[model samples]
Target: MTDTSEMDRRAELSEFLRNRRARLKPEQAGIQPFGGRRRVPGLRREELAYLAGMSVDYYIRLEQGKVRNVSEPILEALTRALSLSEDERAYLRNLVKPSHRRPVSRPKVLPGLLRLLDMAEGVPAYVVGHRADVLAWNGLASAVFTDFAALSPRDRNWARMIFLNRSVQAVFADWTSKGRDTVAYLRVQAASHPGDAELAALVGELSVKSDHFRTWWAAHHVRDHARGRKRFIHPLVGEMTLDFECLRPADGGDQTLVVYTAEAGAASERALRLLANWGADAATGAEAGEPEVGRL
Candidate 1:
């Protein structure tokens, strides 16, 4: 690699560390405040270094982008000190030791995958790509959430909807937490695909348009969007709580199949059935060339 490129990488690593450190409060790290008022928002450099079992000078050098040879043990200590999540730790490792492979093109949702999604009769399922673009979704997913077919291809993005669409905002029971987690998950993707123009543009747009996104992006929180419980405020069926799982193919493309399901005997399950039936009716009406009903 060129010296200039190396310097750029180091600069990014420095900025990431500084941002992570700034988000953590002194008390959160179990540090007692001294006599003077803190000019900085989070723990001081010395305190962080102490907690990481490193010298202040060494930590400063690391933060200054002067040290390139970081050991695993030191990285582990820093991870613990900053209270980094599993995804954050992996991102840190990537920053320190970036992959040499060429940038990957966006993965396409295969026909087989679409068939599988269609087979999920009562479940709401969608495939999300690297930039959280809703590549493909089942009719039940459209019924449960906003209809992706109605939106333009460029707007078929989870991050975009979470921030820009009022309908999406209304659907989430806890919009604040959902927004934060979405941004954090995007951060993880950004780290992995640093050269993706679409991802960069999306982040820039969201940062400019939404204060909530800007604040969460600056916090440097990272999370794996694997499994979680989500509460949705559906206009047709009222409120429903569902468990979601993210599945990846063995071939290892930058795509995940996300499925949301409610407990078998729960009210949420009944609501889901109602939603599926509604979707089927809508499809039938569309096939019969009936006027489309406006989204609720």
Candidate 2:
């Protein structure tokens, strides 16, 4: 609303466009490099404009944040020229045409959702808010991963745990891949809710705390957290591979219900059973006021 805020938004838009353009190589945009040595790392402004079927001056104005009335066709052309992913394309559109509505408050898991999570027997299920904060989790999920109940509310963020928690790092077979994907997913959320102070704080904290996160964030990669195969090396069970699906509630808040399941009669299934048993024991211990020792 203020002049300073408007300037900040435009500056952010400029930086995002520059970063995306810098990541696109000339060859990737079907452009042949000249004989002279180039100073830039990626496609030059003119090269990108040529690939997008637009004039160099027009593209320059768009990148400079001087053109606020960008058309859909032009945005689509830019998306294609930059080889943007679905999430990245959505983010770009949001930057050009931001919603007038304010950012929503942090979402809470509903009672029905908690009941459903509890009823999801033999499956590990958890609810994560827009910022990837673990709002709620079933006992099976706690056993399969880290115990969310043991963690403080502020420390329950998936992004923070992935970077700072050794137990979480140990569980993931490919930590780097998972970390990059997580950061990219968060980047999409940040673009959608640019005014969310909590999200901004999380990003700032992560950037200061983890070099890996800082580098990945600068890359501006974006991904939808829908479905994927996750491999884990459990401390109790040797190794397990699980299929995970992310579900959004019909109520349409920023909460996602993620469920992980193992294939029937497979080794992962047996390992899941072991995890369930251990989880049950852990729950019993908690009921008896014993310290939770199942955390790994």
Candidate 2 C-alpha lDDT tens digits along 175-260:
99899989988977876776777888899999999999999987877887699998999888988999999888786567777899
Summarize candidate 1's per-residue lDDT along 1-296 as a digit string, tens digits.
45544665677788889888888898899987644888888878888998999999999999887777689999999999999888889888877776554444445576566566657667888878878888877677888888777777678789999999999889999999899989988877777765666787899899999999998887777787799999999999999999999888777667788899999899999999998877774321121122234312
Give the CA lDDT, 0 to 100, for residue 126 in model 1. Answer: 81
Model 2: lDDT to the true structure:
0.80
**Model 1 misplaced stretches (Cα beyond 4 Å):** 1-12, 23-38, 100-106, 110-112, 281-296
lDDT of each: 0.80, 0.80
Best by TM-score: 2
Please give each candidate's TM-score. Answer: 0.84, 0.88
